[model samples]
Target: MDYESLYKLIPKEPKKWLTQDVISWLQFIGLGQMEQKFVECSIDGAVLEDLTEKDLDEELGITQRIIKRKLLNWVNHGLKEYNEYIKQMKMPNLNNKKQQDEDFTIQKNIANSQFEQMLIENHENNGNDQFTSSVVRQEEQAIKQEIPGFNKFEHQLILQPIEGQQSNFYCVREAGAKIGRHSSNQILILEENISRFHAEIIFQDSMFALKDIGSTTGTFIKILKSLTLIQGMLIELGSNQFSVQKLDLLDNGGIEISLFVVEGPNLEDTIIFQLNKDKPSVALGRKSTVDISFPEDHHLSNQHAKFYLVDQTVTIEDHGSTNGSWMRLSGEGKMSNLFYLDPNEEIIIRIGTTNQYICQQNKMKVNEISGENLCIICVERERDCLILPCKHNATCLKCSKNLALCPFCRVKIQETIRIYKN
Candidate 1:
């Protein structure tokens, strides 16, 4: 039989005996006597609305497609009845409207008499208007206290700019607050890079979360690392104290790194290096043996610095170069003589006059490198030839044989040198 026909067979007073029992509700909805045992075993204590087709097919041995479909239809009909039953239970009895009206009228009279007495008391106290205003304010506060989800100390999300100058704090009073270029958003960032509705900060279950909402540029959080210092041990960097135990340069795992020369003579330079999983360490230098080599720059030492990732923490130590290295902490514009870095900190490495920005990213983004270590001319073979004078390494040996000028800088190729990788 169809669901509509079976639904008609259910008793009108099923609510009196339903008690949220799945089997009883199914039976009331005209489920067959033979199928009762299977339904009971599958959903012994489930609610009517919670019943799904998958539950019956998987939990019960109901392999027949036609039988399962019919059973699902009946369960859907039962859910509708369950909703109606709940609606009926919550509905006030309109049959006793006259008595309800009388009760409301009596309460209204008592409130009005009390209000009149309060006004009289205020008048007797030398007509103190401030005292009367204070009582009204107190009543408003009491009403606010009775409101659902009202909080005096609402959680706030603070967005500090990368430059470390100013911060925007949002008092999250509702479930969520929008941050975008639009004025309608709770926090409006008026920048060309920001979209109309860039992101949303949601406060749910006493926890705050940020979600990017189809933004063109996308939203990013500056991942901050916590610092732990041992008692009586200090590695001073001007006013800051870094732990000596945390400064072990040989410590190694669990981090990927990307280095970029943010401010330098060559703006196109980018180096992406993944730490060795077994021994999580990377060396930066002018030497060819290092993981990352800056051969063009004379300012960098042969073995400039080393970055270590150990116990889920990242630390950097200088290799004692003639030109000492300096680090710029995250959110700061200026660089400091800090030799070590805490986890999640973005430090600008200054080797002599050259400045390189080192960022510890969640993953290594190789795609960010334009033309990605491949020959620019052929686009098939790896770039093994370095075009000298310009020092542009953007061509293979076969492609470099025909080219007179560098593909990148357009400088005359004094020599075409083939670079061999180990």
Candidate 2:
């Protein structure tokens, strides 16, 4: 429920936030205790922004003066910021029935797929379950074979158009991929705000690295680097997640934060911890050895990710894990064109107003809300390939290449045959 990141993901005029957006903000500001009530009342961003001091006590029943003050302050600040800066970030209508239905489908598919992977991973390789079903052998082999080429794998770049730029994938060879206004670049970004020699996404040391070679506006690649944590950030590591609220800046020169764990059914059974420069690096995973552990979450690797503190800023990095980690990527930051190459992650960067390449599923996962040719899996790119045998035109060339099973029927996919549509 990182509200800022969520807002960055689906930009809208502050007053136009969807219901989901409102829930996220409520959680971030310690107002989540009233989330059920707000949702039951069908309160959306537009309605939330319109609530007044009197309305809070009388209608909303937010009797606490402190709580009422916080709500009013948020509305006033949002209005001030919207009027002074931040354009009407113009994003697609995420609430449309079609869009919501598609999101639900994607969520459903992700859950089912994860469950299938666990079932497959549990099958012993000694042919113990061979006679039971070739399902294990077939799916496991496909996944193993595809894992090697997933990097060389061509994924789509889902651009949420910025006047002139259209969303398209520009595959970067082993050497590197450059993006800018120049026609010679691998990805030609014609946006006026972009510099001529913007930035380069290079594949090095068996991974992708991005470096800005002096751009006027500066290149701000989203994640896979040290991200400065602002107050009220919702950080998620696999199944374990927490909301960090910056408490105060130390007089001696540091920062303190209260980390509140947001999990389980009972809100009353909440857990809170404190973190600061005293703890330089904290490992996070399901293993008891890690600083923070989610023992019950099978999806998390023993050592999944890590958080760091440097110069009053908190940053995060994904450790080498069975499944990669990511967070909501959006908004802006002040970063120079520095080379960023994580041990994990395929190199993908962009120029222009904003790069809508959704964060990988953990957060980096991207999704295209609307488009006639959109892939059913990522839902961001065009449907350009069919699952073998079933031949269902469901996923884009990228997602199609990465699947071990056809998402639609859960059938073991023999191959993804590239197909073109009229």
The per-prediction CA RMSD against the true structure, in angstroms, equals: 33.0, 20.7
lDDT of 2 at 371: 37
The residue pairs found clashing in candidate 1 are: 253-309
TM-score of every candidate: 0.29, 0.31
RMSD of 2: 20.7
lDDT of 2 at 349: 37
TM-score of 2: 0.31
Off by over 4 Å in 2: 1-165, 173-175, 223-338, 341-350, 359-422
Error of 1 at 76 (Å): 72
Per-residue alpha-carbon lDDT of model 2 for 1-422, expressed as tens digits? 24344343333455555455577677767888988767655465556767888877775688888888788888877545643344433334566654444334544565465456545555635555653465665456446534544312222222222123455433333446677788787767677877777766665555555666666544434343455666655454554445565546667555555556553222222343344656667777789988877788776778777777676666777554443444422212323434544433433234544443321211112323223246655547877775544444557889777778778546677666554332
